[model samples]
Target chain A: ELQKQFKQQEEHAGSLQASMNTTQEEITQLRHKHTMVKAAIQEAKWKQANLTRRVLKLVSAQEIERKRGVPLDQTEEQ
Target chain B: LMRQAAHVNAWDQLLQQGHDQVQQLRLTLNNVKTDQSRLQAELDFIQGQQQELEQLIEPLEAAAASTTPAQHQG
Candidate 1:
């Protein structure tokens, strides 16, 4: 009877340890996913910033072109 | 028997804790997706606005170019 009880306890302990290991793995996966998501967000933000800068530059170039009364390409036919 | 029961309870508690963390992670991921989509929409809007402004500038530029030589001559 005592031996049976010891065996049952050992089995329970082993199963619990397995579950803990699985949970740890899940946690690690979640952390990795979060890191990837953060990196993507940062990349999107950088792209948006670059687009905004380009738009501003284009606007400024158009203004300068207007003041000079020149065509956008500024290569007149000879 | 009692020790086995105690281990089962501890295992249950740990599983519940893990479930809660997963739920929180899901919520955070959802929020991040929402923010990313919103920013993307805003970027699209700004791009469209820039195109329209450039289009409007074209006619004005043409008008300015057409009159420039005449104004210089006068």
Candidate 2:
């Protein structure tokens, strides 16, 4: 009876170890994916910053040109 | 016989601990995945905004480039 109980427990331990291995692997993959997502977010923020700066400069230049009363064709030739 | 029972009990305890660890790890993984999805959504939003801003800037850039030299001449 004791041997039987021991064998059952050994089997239980083996299964538990197997499940732990699988869970650890899943966690590792999740962490890697999280890192990639963070990097992408950083990249998107950088692009947004650059685009905003360019838009501001362009808008200001357009305003100055409007105030100067520059003719469209003359400006185009320039 | 008693020693064998003790050994089995120890194994049971270890297995229970292992199960708890697996459960905790699974919860952490789920949270990480959720965060990953949220960040992805944020990235998409920022990229979309950036695209719209770029489109708005294109015509302005063209008009500015054309006007700069005329401003200089005047």
Q: Pick the candidate with the highest DockQ.
A: 2
Could you tell me which residue pairs clash in candidate 2?
none
Off by over 4 Å in 1: A1-78, B1-5
Q: Write the per-residue lDDT of candidate 1 for residues B1-74, one digit (tens) a residue.
A: 77876776676576567657656765766676576667656666765765676676667657656765665675
- Top of the candidates by TM-score: 2
Q: Report, for every candidate in turn, its global Cα lDDT versus the true structure.
A: 0.63, 0.80
Question: What is the clash count for each candidate, in the order shown?
Answer: 0, 0
Clashing residue pairs, backbone N/CA/C < 3 A, model 1: none
TM-score (0 to 1) of chain B for each candidate = 0.75, 0.93
Report iRMS (Å) of candidate 2: 1.5
